[model samples]
Target: MRLRAMVHRHHVLGPGRVPALGFLALLATVLLAGCTSQGGAENSLARPLMQGSTAPRAMSPVERLANDLAMADVAFENGDAKALANHLQSVDLAGATPSDANGEAKLNAWRSSIAAAPPAMRGRVLGPAYLSGILAAGSRINTEQVLLGGKAVSIAAGTAPRDTLRLRIVRGDGKIVCEKSPAHARECRFVPTYTQRFRIELYNTGPEDARYHLVFD
Candidate 1:
């Protein structure tokens, strides 16, 4: 998916600025909680505005890195710094620690990329169909209600050398549609008769930690 200009803007009413900002902060906290919670089934089905092509090419290393940064920018612009930070913190740098120069460089680069965005564009409400987070070693499920009209969906996983990630997609009707156990990345094109809810289940079959990023475009 391409990184385009954000359409939704938050306007503050006079004398209600404090409350508005407070509400937004509260909402962010709640959303993050919901992301981490083993919440009940989600039922809303809203189509994603970003649609992927029929045949998407595999992203080059540089392109993939750029896309990850772009997704972080999207989360940041949408006022979801927690999500962006989570993505950065969960980045698997092949055992590089904070003291490691190479690891620090990559970390700093992620921070700088988000910081370099225009101030006015930071902290807006996030849109639908983009999810990113870290998954511990085990079976984990990340569910989202998305509008799917056969758009191409991309799943990217980052983990240690020995780690493995499996992705399973379940439709609204409780039917499994696609399943893939990939070393790092996977892409599939799916078409739904109409907009509906879908569940994305990720299994960390390996012995180490796993991080993933998903987008429908």
Candidate 2:
């Protein structure tokens, strides 16, 4: 799949916040391992350009998260593993605070889709373990872990467009809130009312690496 259009936004100082405004369009093609990206291409796409500010402002927490998260989205969709890792190196894991032992969780999904392919391809799929959760700062897919993170994170597995991208979103410690399995049916997942840690596992249930563009907010 090819990302026909990607609008990269500027890190603007909004009314007490930073808002990420953009859109995505997908064009299916023979999956490319990754595409050649231009330097500073993302900066040029920033919309609602800004002018003058008296002081250089440090990014707000949400703004910072959005920034790193945005970069991660691009790198992942582009099928650039190293780029994905570098873009998210700044995100601290403090947000994943553990919930109470008795806390209750909620789950919601419009539909569910899991792929069913030949069993022979199983070896190609279950190959990586996102070692240090959230595709950690130094996580290496070639070694052991190659996990991706964000409000929405996906890693497509398979040579063909039949990407069996299995996703599992687990909350702080041992709490499993939402689980979406197989195929290009991207899981919209959940927006938990409570604050907690999230760990995602990408199982490649296809014959080769799957590739697809993701629209992450």
Candidate 3:
């Protein structure tokens, strides 16, 4: 199978007194691997845009993550509560202290900012895992089955610090379409041909406990 097209994007939280540099590095390593040459893109349609004098240079994964966090900080400082929430979520606090006093203060502040918003808005702003302090780590397995329906599919997965994650997709014909083993602090994405059934597998191989989230569309 060939990758026809692919896009990589992330929903990250603001850098609120958390050790963000380490997290940014982790995301950068993972997303950058997929961005560069993960799917054998010698003839792939989704190539990186050329940097010309008239065109702005592309931001590397690290730069992009840093920019997102910086923007989130700016939004928070400007009292753009919704914008802040849009950028800051539970994922951003993956390896940090979400139950400590400082963490609780930050969570409460965010909740108060959106307390008057509509119920749906509130739900979206503060995700179900907000302040829950759930961490991903150790060896774990998660399987998901999906129907391709002749449409292109993209799967992106990432783990926290000191975590390694691997993904494999098996087709209805018992064919392995895509596989990725992202070592510690790596993010991965894959695009596979349409198939009747796709069995997606996620594996954690890190010594320390880690958490991961997957985005499939």
TM-score of each model, paired residue for residue: 0.42, 0.26, 0.39
Tens digits of per-residue lDDT for model 1, 80-190: 766676555433321112323543454555576554422222343432133445567766756665756656554433333323777678888989877767634454446
TM-score of 3: 0.39
Deviation (Å) of 147 in candidate 1: 1.8
List model 3 lDDT by residue over 136-155, tens digit each: 44454545556555565555
Q: When superposed on Cα atoms, how far off is each prediction in RMSD?
A: 31.0, 31.1, 31.0
The residue ranges of model 2 lying beyond 4 angstroms of the native Cα positions read 1-160, 212-215
Instruction: Return whichever of 1 and 2 wins on TM-score.
Output: 1
Candidate 1 segments exceeding 4 Å error: 1-109, 113-129, 150-163
* Better TM-score candidate (1, 3): 1
Model number with the top lDDT: 1
Lowest summed lDDT over 10 consecutive residues: which window, candidate 2? 103-112
The lDDT of each candidate is 0.52, 0.34, 0.48
TM-score of 2: 0.26
Among all windows of ten consecutive residues in candidate 3, which has the lowest summed lDDT? Answer: 125-134
Candidate 2 local lDDT, 56-92, one digit each (tens): 6664333344344445445555666565555444332
